[model samples]
Target: KPSIAGKLDNIQGDIWSKGFPKYYETYYFFSIKTPLLNEKNLFSQCLKNLSTQSPRLISTLRMVREDHNRISTRRKEEAIKQGIPEKRVVLPEIPMSNALIAFTIKGLQAIQAGLQDDTSLRLTDVAATDPAFFAGMTPKEVTALLKDPDQDTWDPLFRSTEIHGMLKIGGSSKGKVEEHLKNIKGVLKHGTAIDDVFQDSPSTPTDSRVDGWTRPNDRGKEHFGFEDGISQPLMNGIDEQEPGTNANTDVNMYTDPRLLIVTGDTKRESSIPRPPWMENGSFLVFRKLEQNVKAFEDLTEQWEKKGCESKEHMGAKLMGRWKSGAPLAVVNFYTEDSKDPDKAKEMNNFIYENEVCPVSAHIRKTNLREDLTENDKDPRALRTKIIRNGIPYGTDYKGNENNTKLTRGLLFACYQAHIEDGFQNMQVNWSNDSTFRTGHPGQDPIIGQVAQKSRGVNGDLETFFNDKFGVRQSVKFQQLVTMKGGEYFFVPSIPAMSDDLGM
Candidate 1:
């Protein structure tokens, strides 16, 4: 048999650390599959629980193909230039595990409606708390109402409207949004809807329970205000999705070996034991991060006059990318050449020499090849590579200026082999590491904090602009890059969900 490395290409794209391109919704979590006599029967039933509005595998393939078209054209061109048949550039054909599922309140409503024949059980309470019952209602006002513990405001969103369906590329639409999404011109016609890529949900009994899910205004932007999700890790054998790789190599540029293997799969000289379910599963962190839009805007304005230039430059410098998702690490100050296709190869082809692109920038800090040097003494950064899986939750212009409303932030979910070594340590240590800050050994400018009493946006945006000033002089990161949210969950592999007493 071929080595596991050879079988690497056989693994699906979505299961890897970076994640697949699709929308997702998180349903209420169920206990690990229980080991019982009825369990085998439930396994089949559980599989039925997993449903999607779109053909999972097909939608995934379309996304992968689109990505291939963008990243592979250059390699095809290169092969042509080298006097070689472009067809020789063998690209890997891989399937992506569909991480998204959909089971709306309407779906549940149908089930409940079917069960209405039973007069003893009242469906009233179930209908009342379900968000699907009120599909088009004001989610904000409804959210406030729902928080009142006594109010039952979730009824209407669950009552399925034809428009509230998932828009498919081929099949007939299912919901209200699905129907409109299909006819929305450039939006949902081609392959999948943009929102679908970022908003798909797991099929569970609780989806219809949502008051209404909203996308944050600053969602596409990271903590530093740059558009994110531009560069993702491509599995080595799977296919190259990131910018640079050509044919043989370029088609596989995003595959970073550090993230390929699960924690316990490989032998370690240090002898750290990988957790029990570490191999096939991933750990996710769902944080309700709240951003101070007004404060962030003001800081950008102040930094601009001090030579940071436009919002785009400051955004790129701080986030290592522009709104277009171009990384400052790869192309500093947004050069036309970087976008010229010729120079836009490796996303990591960055020159860290200049302070123009701050070392404390979110992208650089999160992916510091330097800080991750000691994987043995502390596999902190290396082990912290969890797949970020949640979407921006909240509304547009809800709390943009003032109004005291905490409008938006990420439902920050990250999947990892080990939670302790991954998300937990990264947030508590690296992201909060003052020493990791580029110049002043200051707090990580993005997610770091100053004392609670002295907390607010850093007053001196200029001092922290470049690494010129000292750490003490740097402004404290007052923005909440992430915030509190609901329960923690462990997503299981299909097998795990069906075996071992739903542990």
Candidate 2:
């Protein structure tokens, strides 16, 4: 059907190659679980037949600048044949296959009040969209829609208010994620509040939660054994910079410069303009997180049987990387030297201001990039940048962690424009802050939510390994990532979700 009407004009891949897409991909997470039913053409013609099917979006203006100018001319001919002094490398994309969707301001007013008594759509067709998507906004906008992460700080099996929208199929074949879930079960097999929000249909629904991806060598590792999507950010703008121009801005910092600059792009007008039919929309922030892989391999194998320095260096110092994604501030503790192979393509380039990678690690408290750039005006550290696209539901051990009874961990997604300036200011000011903006570096000992001192906000991660060793280091414990369910979505622009909520 002209390739399913060319997926209503593509555009979904981001977060560096479809948020780390590549290698036998086959994820599917869906979870609408019904609610808002005033019956507007059953969830707007099942999201306008999921925007006419070829929808595994692909429109970020062909991510390439001559493949980052041939990997920066092969890292300047391998740094002038190994004498060193040539680094910055990026190639970023290459994967694409689609199925994506996201919505929830109660699923866009349950499809704008299910197409508002259809005299053919109006409310000024979504009431001039985005006053933070309608009817008098301001519930303090977004700090996770004012908490309810499962009644009192999480783990009621992650109940953050019954999900209303999020389909996200993504492929690389498990029969292309079941033919994009059989075209979303033939658009919810003749909908009824959309087949009671699809629990693989038969009109199920009462409760459901799903998360997938585990093939690319067990999805490039995150079942708590390190190696995940790797750090990300970059969107660049220099009148699209000339001269062999190939500024890769890793999956262009989660895109959506109001689609692609000011006919829609005008950086967050005092925070909440985004909605010229949501130019290439993007704002999901789902999270279900649950990892405990036998308490992360029994506290990193008791710090590798007390001969400490090898549970791959205590999971590379609580994840500043080194589960073979490398980057414990330029790869050490466990090793990565092959004649300085351009330091693993400058692993998301470094910095912690000589703190030697430990401003609460977990990618240096979520993206500090070039240490929030000296004076280049770091938009509050690039508005708490995010672009992660999660996957890792369950099953992990043979020593290989938790051999599942379902309910494993990590489905933590993210894509931004504003979920309160990127995932609620990096989950309440940097993974539950321990005095950070630059170093007091506590909490975030691998996805901190708070534990041990239980809600005492002492997930402990302070450090100072050696500056004349005045001594100061830590690695406390508690909820090794456990927020059961979450949501806050938008994902528009499959031709503005088939022309503004398919009205």
Candidate 3:
């Protein structure tokens, strides 16, 4: 509502007030065996309690702009010492514990038992309510893109029937996180949280990929050491809390970016008005992607041994950005140590048409922002955006690959308004299609799903020694990251959770 122009602040509290809380997070999956009434009531009451307990909620009169001048002055002095531009310094606030929950179709039915008529239809229709959610990802007819197949051939957990619901608990510190988990454990026990709660669904986490600070100084980076989470589309309608006010309702919101990247698709008849309960909500896609660190390291070592101009470019072309988070199009070189804050200002301000960065580069293929029509600000690119909010789970191995037994990877989570247009289109129409964005650019070497035999200039989108020119020496990359567990869910707004949806 803050971004809706003349409306009041979203009273449910901005989900990002603490700005990505918890250094450690756990995705607690659950299913129910209790009566439908008990499950629904328990979840509803818990939400009411959580609404008030959500960390850093903007319900005060002084947190808004109260210490802006004083804080800005301190920030400026700190920026000078850190060598960052004064305007870019983000003031740190002590974070607190936060919690959120999501439910699948089976999970929803277990709760809303009475939301049915002769056919048993619910008042609020969520992703679980739609057949498409259970159908999972597929090659949409027009898009003609390949998708992670719905078979045992793919990861079993990702097979629609694996996960029911996930309770995500995060806190500012390890102690707080553990404490929150303990409290939630108590709440979820004795048939309140679920009918039968197992610690995990796909058995216990065997080899965890959880680690810390994958950046120069903890910028968003993946375990592979490449900087992550750049080029995120601005959530225009949502505004942050300011000082001296409970929320930024009448103040800072005036200047909040008004460009909404996730608007409702008016062209899609079934989704024109969207569901009333789904107005400000978004779809949450979860994937438990496992990364083989040693394997990735081996690939890099191979490239390093064959020293050449494009040796460094090899890694950059794989992701479209250097490990330092600098985009290849902007830096024009693979710099391993440049962590300049200024680079972020234009991290997403370049294109790869002339092949400065290969067309099949991971970033270019997923975004296609400026490549749409040579126009940098293409609205078409906006529709395919998703807000990624994943966290690195598990820890690393102890020794070399030979003596290691650690399992680690990313808890890949992304929010989009439309599953088909946002997540599906990117995977099928763009990332999987070598012919997309440019002529036969090849598959996304990072996450593309074509079999090795299908890989080529057209079908598989193999990585060209230099894809810019018609290079014949194309390297077919194997799948390093594997999809182990996945689920499609709807993250309802606070109002939808409590009042509008009749939870």
lDDT of 3 at 364: 76
Best by lDDT: 3
Residues 405-491, model 3: lDDT tens digits: 466777887766666756767877777776775568777777776643443434333664463344544566456565555667665
Q: Model 2, which residues run further than 4 Å from truth?
A: 1-164, 167-191, 196-275, 279-282, 287-292, 302-306, 309-316, 319-351, 356-360, 363-365, 374-403, 411-415, 418-503
Please give the CA lDDT of all the candidate structures. Answer: 0.39, 0.51, 0.53
- By lDDT rank, best first, the candidates go 3, 2, 1
- Ranking under TM-score, best-scoring first? 3, 1, 2
Between candidates 2 and 3, name the one with more favorable TM-score: 3
What TM-score would every model get versus the actual structure? 0.56, 0.32, 0.74
Evaluation by lDDT, superior candidate among 1 and 2: 2
Q: Which one wins by TM-score: 1 or 3?
A: 3
lDDT of 2 by residue, 1-503 (tens): 01112222344543332232332333333334343545335555556556654532332323323233444577677777776766333223333345566666655655655454543333343333333333221233332333323345444323434345656665444565555555675665524444333344444442343546663345456787665664544333312322322222422433333332112333454443433665546666676677777777787787667554556666666777666566777655555451232344445544545655566777777766554444354455555566576777666654653435545676777776655566666766776777765547676677656332344355333432322232455656655666655656667665666664445
For every candidate, C-alpha RMSD to the true structure in Å: 12.3, 20.7, 6.9
**Residue 394 miss distance in model 3 (angstroms):** 3.2
lDDT of 1 by residue, 1-503 (tens): 11224433223223343343333333222221222343233322433333222343222323434444544575577687776655334333332223322222332233223232432222343233222232322234432321211113222222223212221121111132233333332222222211222213545423422212323344244443444454444434444344453211211332243343333233232244332322333334434455556666666676666643665566565565555555565565557844333333345444355555566666665665444454555545554455564555445443345566536555555555444555545555555555654455444455553333343344312224452242222434445343433322333333332232123
